[model samples]
Target: MDLPVGHIVTVLEEMGIFEDDSEPPFEHWLVGRLEGLAPGIRSEAERWTRVLRDGGPRSLPRREGTVWLSLNQVCLALLEWSNRYDHLREVTRDDVLAHVKTLHGHQRRDQPVALRSLFTWAKRQGVIFRNLTSRIKVGQNEYAVLQPLLPEQVERSVAAALTPAARLVLAAVRAARVAQIAVLVLDDVDLGNRRLIIAGRARPLDDLTLKLLADRLPTGDAGGRAPRTSTTPTRPAVPATTGSARRCKDRTPPLERLRVDRQLEETLTHGPDPLHLAEVFGLDEKTAMRYADSARALLEQDAESGFSRDTRQGGNE
Candidate 1:
């Protein structure tokens, strides 16, 4: 009853254990296991699978004395174990060692390491948590528990998409009386061929971000039920610098513009991306870019004065 390597490989192949590219076209684990199997062990396993597939009134295969398990069987067993112990606490190395020993009906065996390998596989696929804690030590082993990302961290991670200003605007819109925030849609705010979507009535956003939001918004009415008209708005005959801020005129003046002007300038000048710049300065994409461009231009025009230019101008710190 000596198992041949080829026969063992064949059995594993039937069980889908090997990858398609395996040299012998067997399951992934077959190659590694082949070393332990006696020659011709694989042919015997192949015969077993063939008999089962033929449905020739043969008894079902038994695992009692078998050293081989198919890929599907391994998966099924792990899944069943997971479901049964879904509420269990984090598994320490010792806990895993115990489970493997118990599941395989062995005592004082290398079950703990085996269980760890299985858990590692599951953890990589996000099926289970991989905690990294130094709290417990079993035979010189340490463990950690897996947990979901915190809400605050998640918010910070994606905060780049919604600039601080955008976030503020969103907050205002959500908190404002719905009646006061009517007709919130993307539109050409400056009428300079640049478009924007109005987000909140609490305060106005600069042009770059407004344009980005307007461009990205779904084209439709509220509730996503109505189709939007495709007509583009016409450009204004004359563009006006409607905002209160005026460019600096001094060859070298003191602090000028709003308190956040320096931060805004830094954001625009060196942000990794327009969107990133917007988030850094709390402005939207278009406004962020526009501000960056404007800042550079204004500073260049007044380059003689350098960065520490005219104070008392609007937004001057």
Candidate 2:
């Protein structure tokens, strides 16, 4: 069973291991643990242990707990695959790939990151001539299919929103994610120009969105001009909007789903062009392509169903 690094460190401290002046207690303990391994493997593991302990030349310093966690993952990988090679320098890209394939779920994803960190530091330190894990890719590729919410569902959700802030969140979902909405400040809103700067990109505000924003803004003075404040207030937390959606009588989709639905609507209005999606939503190329492909597939399916319906009608005539 695995124990936390803190527990292990406390136990070691109690044993008076830290009293020694020869080397750091953690490094000494790590080396002692790897004593059963081959000399070549143990030597490389020790190098990594020291590198992690000291925080390598190019890397930012990490806390003691973080250092131990990272070192644990890297050391485990090295020890497990020790039989395949005598030294880390002898390990090739194929060796790294083979090791990574043995892991499952989060381990499969995170082990590569640990390996990259180790090899990158090793290369910079001249311990290894090349970073073998540089080209290796992990994690999922295909995006999950997002079903757009119906127009009636959106209408009900809008009507159900009780607070001006909640309404603002619902309106902003057309352009920004929940995270972006949560961080929105008064400076990001341009009521006079009818635009909102979302994630550093200017999104044109629709009339409903504009009205919702106006509802949230402070009331004007007796002369009718809006009062200017020295400091801007941030929008409400994510829970504010999510709570509003949860309170709806009918099942309203989460903010993210609503955002996807809005994107699909945009694709339907314009065309399923990745470039257009990227510019409008400020999404990366890969994400834009995924959305574009999803929209295109949806359009094709609709066309096929329409053609089938036309054929059935002609047969009936």
Candidate 3:
């Protein structure tokens, strides 16, 4: 039977291998595991493992299992690369660069970070004469650009939203994240004021959005206040609403795509100002800048297309 790491640790503790007072440190397990390696390499691995356990700038507060796995993988990779070298100190910058080149994707990016940390620590401890990875630079990973929902697609999605919940989700995603929408209660909506309190901010409610909320919510009391119940029966799950939207024959864009499309539309309308986007959409400066950049690119493409059309017409004349 495949036992979990917690179970294994418990078993070890029960067997008196670990003290009864506290859980065994991750380095202890890592040290035992590295016993098969050469004495020099094993000692180096142990030191690195201890460095991870002690928690510094290089170390993240990850789970013991994740740390153990990562440590083992890094050690194995180093071991494979260091086979020809007489000692860790003999491993040059070119050797480190060559090893890094052999990896791909996140591994290519992450391994260098680990190497830099390990070598920096080793140099500080006087274990190595020099930090081999000091000058080795790894570029940040490039993420795929998120495609916003096209105008026609957005229109089709809105038209296809048949249910009150579906319509509410479509409306809410224009100004709020799906997570915020999922937890919305009748208290968050102010139909009389035509506004919604989303993530502690008051957002203006359109007439259509107000109507959708009214249809979903229970009838108001004598004082004209909505019942205290949640907006949807599944108050904390937006999937049901999204699922309802997807029931249509046409492929409906996800709520996230709709939110992106909304942001892009706002950017285009307001002239792609990152500060304005940040304030309006509650986006960080970096994220707002990315949206602004995307909007600018779109505008430039439109201008180029228009210019080409005019040139073609002039040539025809």
Candidates arranged by lDDT, highest first:
2, 3, 1
- How high is the CA lDDT of each candidate model? 0.36, 0.68, 0.67
Show model 3 residue runs off by greater than 4 Å.
1-79, 82-92, 103-131, 140-148, 159-163, 174-178, 190-198, 201-215, 218-251, 303-317
Instruction: List where candidate 1 sits over 4 angstroms from the true fold.
Output: 1-33, 44-149, 160-217, 221-317
What is the alpha-carbon RMSD of candidate 2 to the true structure?
10.9
- Taking the tens digit of each residue's C-alpha lDDT, what string does model 2 give over 156-269? 667777776578777777678766776666666777776778888877665556666777676545543234565535533233565554453244666666677667666655
- Which ranges of candidate 2 are over 4 A from the true structure? 1-95, 103-117, 134-140, 191-194, 206-208, 218-252, 307-317
Candidate number with the higher TM-score (1 or 3): 3
State which candidate has the highest lDDT.
2
TM accuracy, model 1: 0.20
Candidate 3, residue 312: Cα displacement in angstroms equals 24
What RMSD value applies to candidate 3? Answer: 9.5
What value of lDDT does candidate 2 attain over all alpha carbons? 0.68
Instruction: Report the Cα lDDT for residue 90, model 3.
Output: 64
In angstroms, give how far residue 132 of model 1 lies from its true place: 37
Highest TM-score: which candidate? 2
Better of 1 and 2 by lDDT: 2
